[model samples]
Target chain A: MASVLPRTVQGPPVPLRWPPEDNRIPREIFTDPDLFRWEMDAVFTGPVWVLVGHEAEIPQPGDYKTLSVGAVPVIVVRGADGQVRVLVNACAHRGARVVEGPRGNVLKGGFRCIYHMWTYAPDGSLLGVSLPDDFPVEFRKEDYGLPRARVALYKGLIFASFHEQTPPLEEYLAELTQGMDRVLGDGRLRYLGSIKVIFRTNWKLYVENIYDGYHVTALHTGFQVVRLRSHGGQRLVPNYERNGHLWGQSRSTRREELQPVLRDMSLFDVRTKPTTDHNMMVVFPSGVVTDYFDTIQLRYVLPLAVDQTLIEFTFFARADDPEDVVRHRVRQGPAVLGPAGAITLEDAAALERVQQSSVARGDNVILKGTPKRFPPYRHVDEAPIRHFYQAYRRLIGVPVEEGTP
Target chain B: MNNADDLSVREQAARELLARYVRVVDDPDRVEEWPDLFADQAEYRVVTRENLEAGLPISVVCDDTKDRIMDRVTVIREFWGAGGRLEDRHYNQVRPRHVVGPVWTEPQEDGTVRVVANFVVWGTPTTDPAPRLLALGEYRDVVEFTARGPRFRSKWVVLDTPVLQDVFVYPL
Candidate 1:
């Protein structure tokens, strides 16, 4: 069992307390304008580093992709010098997005703005000007280059933080790093492809939903029909940590469980032995890495507002995988998860419904998974939510024991 | 003059094939009719807009062989999956470009047509009850002429929509 920190700290070890063991999460967190403002400053732009993407997504030199860190749009580009850099997507002049496309190669060693042709190098250094004589001598090209956010990479996952005072990426990840490394298989990954879906729910809701095994049987009834079940009973083996990360392990059910329901359950019976434990890891704030069978799925949850989130699911294959296997993975990719995926679609629908119902009720939704029977179980069982809210309360400078109205 | 007449006929056939494909997928009453558009050895895929625009060799939804397509359709149509409640419609526009390939002298025995056309598909959903646009993309097709006219040998949905609205259930 894990240990609980206090709600308030004086000097170094801040004691954090979990909220009251009630199912209801305050409705204010979802709809309040002030809370959203606080989160943008304290959570998204705070000490935690948000995972923008895997390094494999932009592999070659000049390759670039756009990502959103909270509301700030950023461009992750691989330069000609073979270094990956993250820069604010906004132009230095009028705040226009320098790169409009999702992912591409700049080809000319730098990116040129479409609006005014203001060019910049891959490392956010100013390259050249469209018209040199127009600006004054004081307008230094060095000063006009793209602005960069603090960037770090763990295994191949790249993370960026807007705040300079944020903790080091490794220190911030803590125990969550191990689970991320496991998903990467020690940095052996290739870009398969991705499916980006926009959902009408708070980003936190999506993150919380990832490790909540309790919703699988009830909300994801489609999985049961498709014969996708855990070998180990329905309950998930939860591993909670001090950094607010949770990793759940479940056994893959035998083929027989799926045979009765699915007409073509044999399609997945490709003589491949399941060597690794099926794992689901939720990184603090907004990243979920799930290893389903042999496939590695990474989901980056980006918040648009208190009520909107953009969920990007990227599927990966081993870099040395056979051509047929790669093709097979691609074919099976859309079938299991993502917006086009059978299982993911249900989750998306359920999330939207949950949002709507919660709005109608206008009250705190209760979390029943809180463990109260034994003190030992309290840390591992009910502590994740408590840990999360404690982190939230600390960041937002809210009093934890403030009673509900 | 003979070449012009042949080109016109081929172009008309391509247009007809695309129209039929769209009609089948958009039909609310007969959903299964859409799957019948493919031949026994047909292939289908749905790729991202970014990959399509960049001309990258990656697909978000890929069904290589007829057996694979059958397995996918069977799972969704028969087996209960997560995206069971979605009702979608594909509105496509096709443009035929002349290319030198095997000209069809007669209908093939395997019910396959041999033709190529560039197509664009716009998908809209009825579930949200607000008539929302789901996806927009281009389709590069390889059609075969069967005894019953023309069918798709392969259809790749090269999407151009920035973000997928929700989930894509059926083949495009």
Candidate 2:
């Protein structure tokens, strides 16, 4: 909550190229408190859609979970009408956070603000304010109902938009779902479990890292184990791209991606047949969805500060999967992607190292091995990074010259 | 030894083994000795209390066998070998009580004793001001009664705090 700043306090004009070229990002943007403020204004609050929670998480009616989009608290609840509602968690009366902790089922009288006892229904309707007879004449109870953001649900995943005018979630993700990356398989996703960790790095760095195909074979330690057993001829290509959404495809079962302890041959055999492939998707701003091997993980990134990022990783098992498959997901999900994932741990260390060095005056280069305007799907191309930077530049408040991206 | 004395000896041995377990885990220089502390088929995990209560199948460190534990040690040696995560030391001091309801040892005919103890481990990272609480939880340990000494058949680390900072490269 401390990360969100007032809109009035302005900072110096950013001293750099308006639209950075050659896949270069000004290092100041990584460390500048002012740019972070503008990011809150333009990127987060301006037409950006945030993925709040999946319906499976708040299954029962009256169940609610607390989340935030750039420090603005939000409550994702299931109403008695059986529709999931996304409401601002701040109390309308005194601005106190109405929901406590991460999640819970609503008690009697809906949710009561502990600070002033103002109550609200599950549908975000105002129930009552404390000592209503003593209120001023102009104050109407109906006028202060819990303010809600525009909400949309696609395949059980809930998305909320804070902007006054943003496209629907489906329209926003139009091009990508047609090809390359598509998951949430047949709309029967089982809610497995969750874990969160704070990285000592900028939030953008982690978001870009998600669609990264270049670094997988090099950085993640577990990949080496799988590669050793996998058929050595596998290749990765930019499988799909559109509207700030990008994904890569490669064989999910190259050598049998085996965990030494829990042997699930299916994970290794997923892509061996022509039927399946691994997919990584990044919905602009900071919603990452991945489906590879035996697990489906949703990466929710929260920008806490210029130098700190909070990442919540939630894994899901297929609803139709047997107990063995679910157990396999529990064992193997973290092995590849969570806080304790083999490659994820290394990524955290490398990101923090960059955070320490990023404060200096410099250009963070992304044009490592690509010459194409949109880059390619090769293991070392900067295409995904370039794709993200374009969306970021267009959304940010600064003016850009003609033909920037 | 008689019944009372035999029980005392077993408890004393269990206590010493538990201390040695912590000492081995805390020493970064002696990482090779970690896998030896457990039996080959040992079950090890570092899980959140909430996940445990909700029956959620997720963990910070979930290894069903000692081979996976050894793999972690191998990663520290090769993957994060030179300069991986922040340099740190662990201070694990087990607070044990004499005969208690939840902690009574059950000796098995298969040469194993099930012992449960409580522990609080502190971490002193190079960047932190002082030692801070890393994890505080109960250890549901299965100690084998071998002639060579007590070794863990399984050790479940159920942490009360779910949220953790950065990476959990090292074991809890």
Candidate 3:
């Protein structure tokens, strides 16, 4: 069944270009079923380590949580010996999922299957089968243990990779590690829980939407009412890099700089004093960690298909924080990123609208952020997205073809 | 005021207070009335069933006093934060299951009347015309009757739903 690629076809023979330097992303990337399949193989199961969760999520031994790795469901558990393990949730025999709950502790021992009473150790080693006499000579319980996935941790953040060739998690994180470290800090963290929402648009749209700084002022004007009114309007100055990573800083005129427009400022006392260095970081494929004053937000994007994505928003605070401070941080943080969050709610609506609009348009969507006159700017521009497409082209092995509106 | 029946009446009043609290939240415009239903010293919390069962000290929403409740309402309505049109209705079926101590004539002076009830809040989103089920959760409240009427001294909302649909901004 895996070999059946949907709608696979060779485009009309055209001039072949190596590492094509086109800034525009083909619209098919969003809606093509075949491309989606290829992405699951090339990106998700490829050499990139995907952030599974934070260590704070399962702090105690025997504690476990279930999540998906691409299309595959995985269970992350902390054994009694104080080691974290990621195991494929599927049962070794009938392939049924072992744990269904989001999180819980396995009392007395390891996970036991309800179907046949197949018990496994907390670390995913096969413990004992219900019956031994019925098994064939070659049917060894040890060989039937739960399969484990490669797991790695940086600071307290946990990540997993299916491909053995993936670079070390630290090297893959690259420059993004600095920002992530700052967010985690030296303090221990507790699982503040998670909010999961499914968006109708393709997952990449969600990733790009968060990474693109150009849309904030116009798209999120309603929620930014206080920020704009206080700062006398702000613009995002984006800094893009080569490895499909981008960070942006929001610059706004201070109260003293624009005293005339800042009259009756007490009306918007809710606005925290503006900081010059409001940073937004995007780690390609998935994972976006943003730092606002007094609060930090982690948005993990899991793509289910070309048109479906599961977005989980998890909030964190210092483990030893005062009750009041933790509560304050949770409240303020959700105001920006949660389901009722100002920016995300609008983005959700926009994503739905874009999905509807794209159905009527042609096969290509132009990324205007990329210039056409000069060769697509290499370092400073939206070339990161272009670079991503270049990587996409290599993995999918798709020949570049041109089309007219 | 010194009659023996005053004790039963006060107990009934405590139950009535919780009922009124549910009604206020159901009424969209009257949601602002929640703060007044509590005493000057009140505690409110919104937490998940897991945390509550595990005896974990955490809540998605926690307010210490009427002032704090008022501040939350003010921020939700006027603050330049996240915004979406939502409709939440709380249905609390309060049953005067038991009375802890000897009923007292003056309800505020003696802490005898204790009322416990089970509640369910149905939250629906209005932004989308379809109006899907956004959240369903239970509420546990402890009420105390005062001379004026009944006031909620403490309320805890425990949600059974495992995955929170989105950020819970309004009281459930």
Worst ten in a row by lDDT for model 2 chain B: B89-98
> How far in Å is the alpha carbon of A309 misplaced in model 3?
4.1
Q: Show the lowest summed lDDT stretch of 10 residues, model 1 chain B.
A: B88-97
Report the lDDT tens digits of candidate 2 across residue range A2-35: 1122355343346544334647777777888878
Model 2: runs farther than 4 Å from truth?
A1-22, A179-181, A225-243, A257-276, B78-138
Displacement of residue A54 (Cα, Å) in model 3 is 1.8
Q: Pick the candidate with the highest lDDT.
A: 2
Q: Across residues A1-405, which tens digit of lDDT does each residue of candidate 1 receive?
A: 111111222221222223454344665576555566567666766656778888888999889999787777889988888778888887888778898877888757477787778888888887887777967878988788787877788888888777666678777776666667766767767887777888878776677676466667655555566566665522222222223665666665665556455333443443233442566776667777777655677888888877888888888877778887776666555566657664566566667666656555445443445544211221123324544554555566653454521
User: CA lDDT of A61 in candidate 3?
Assistant: 89
TM-score of 3: 0.73
Clashing pairs in 2: A214-A379, A229-A255, A230-A254, A230-A255, A231-A255, A238-A377
DockQ of each: 0.28, 0.38, 0.14
> Considering chain A alone, what is the TM-score of candidate 2?
0.88
Model 1 shows how many backbone clashes? 19
Prediction 1: B-chain TM-score: 0.65
TM-score of each: 0.80, 0.86, 0.73
lDDT of 3 by residue, A271-315 (tens): 333463344666556776666555566667878777878887777
